[model samples]
Target: MIGLILAIILFNFIAFKTNRRHTQNSILHIWLFTIAFQLIFDTMIEFKYHGYWYFDKEVDWLGLLAHTLLIPPVNMIFLNWYPLQGRLRSRILYTLIWVAAIMGYELLTLLPEPWGYFHYGWWNLWYAAILDPFLFYILIKFYRWIRSLEERI
Candidate 1:
């Protein structure tokens, strides 16, 4: 968690310094996609672990919400920091990074003996494996849409 936070900060710093051409709309769209993805995935995990019932625990709920919101912004920061020149290259890099990060997180979760909020169930692993490609495709499509809109203006 600490490492993730630090990485986000560092990425943001570099992105802001270098990617001055990035528009607010681009950033917002990226953030929206990220938040939506996190919310969906986290909700699924929560349901699998804690059943259909929701919790009144403010801390847990807030933490989940906060992380969901943070996902896109952090992702945007990294993507902007290393802005890809071509669509194909961007999509490939995006897919690779997302997969790598998810795998690393899963590994960390498994390493500390049930230290993570979500367990390494077969379903969860399968979900994670499938989600990366889906997210990459969605992000690429969305990014192209945004670029087209920008060109029209």
Candidate 2:
């Protein structure tokens, strides 16, 4: 659980410290959206199909910590630094870099019990590498939509 605790602290610290683009309202929206989105996906992958799970393969508070606190800040960091106005090549490259970093982080989460909090069933790093871009695409689209709504208000 130490790994999970450290990640929650570091990711949230960096997210709040480094973010300059989003307003307070937008950050709140993004935080809630990320948590809800992750819950939906996790319900299927972690519970239904048992693709993978955090801490354990059953519903627990530690897994909730991983879902709510650990990931949304990372999403915040991702959207905060995303090259929104970059050319297509740069945007794609940026996404690729984030994907690689996420994959590496996933590997770290798989280390062991006290240090590592992640577990695999039928899932693998390749699966994450393949799916992360699409997940990021959805997140970007959602953020764009949120911005559009905010602009009109």
Candidate 3:
């Protein structure tokens, strides 16, 4: 609980405060897209499949806090820092670094009780590792598409 709360505060602060690149509209779009995407993915994996869940195996309202507050800002921060103009190799490397950080954080969230909010049933870090790059790719593509739309508008 404490861990998740602190992380939410810190991540939101960093994401919003340090954002010099995206406009308010863009940020709003990104936030909405992230929440919707996460909810869809979690609904399938956490609920339908019972792969993993937040706080407990059963559905809980507290888990919504983790879903709504924690990850979108992290995604914001990620897109904010992404090297859009950099070489392909640099971009790939940057993504891998973020994946490692995410995996590390996921590990921390597997800790007991008050500190931990995440749990696994059949899912594991390896699954996340495989999925994250594709996820990041999707985010990048979405951001680019949004940017293109913004340019036309």
> Number of the top candidate by TM-score?
2
Clashing pairs counted in every model: 0, 0, 0
Write one digit per residue (lDDT tens) for candidate 3, span 1-153.
988998999999999999978888888888899999999999999999999999887789999998888998999999999999999999999999999999999999998878888999999999999999999999999999989999999
Clashing pairs in 3: none
Better of 1 and 3 by lDDT: 3
Model 1: per-residue lDDT, tens digit, 1-153?
444344446556765567655698887777777777766765665554542221222236535644554456546655554444668777577677878776776555443322333344334555666777776666667777887899899
Q: Write the per-residue lDDT of candidate 2 for residues 1-153, one digit (tens) a residue.
A: 999999999999999999999988889988899899999999999999999998889999989998899888999999999988889999899999999999999999999979899999999999999999999999999999999999999
TM-score order, best first, reads 2, 3, 1
TM-score of each candidate? 0.62, 0.98, 0.97
Poorest lDDT segment (10 consecutive residues) of candidate 2:
22-31
Q: Return the TM-score for candidate 2, rounded to 2 decimals.
A: 0.98
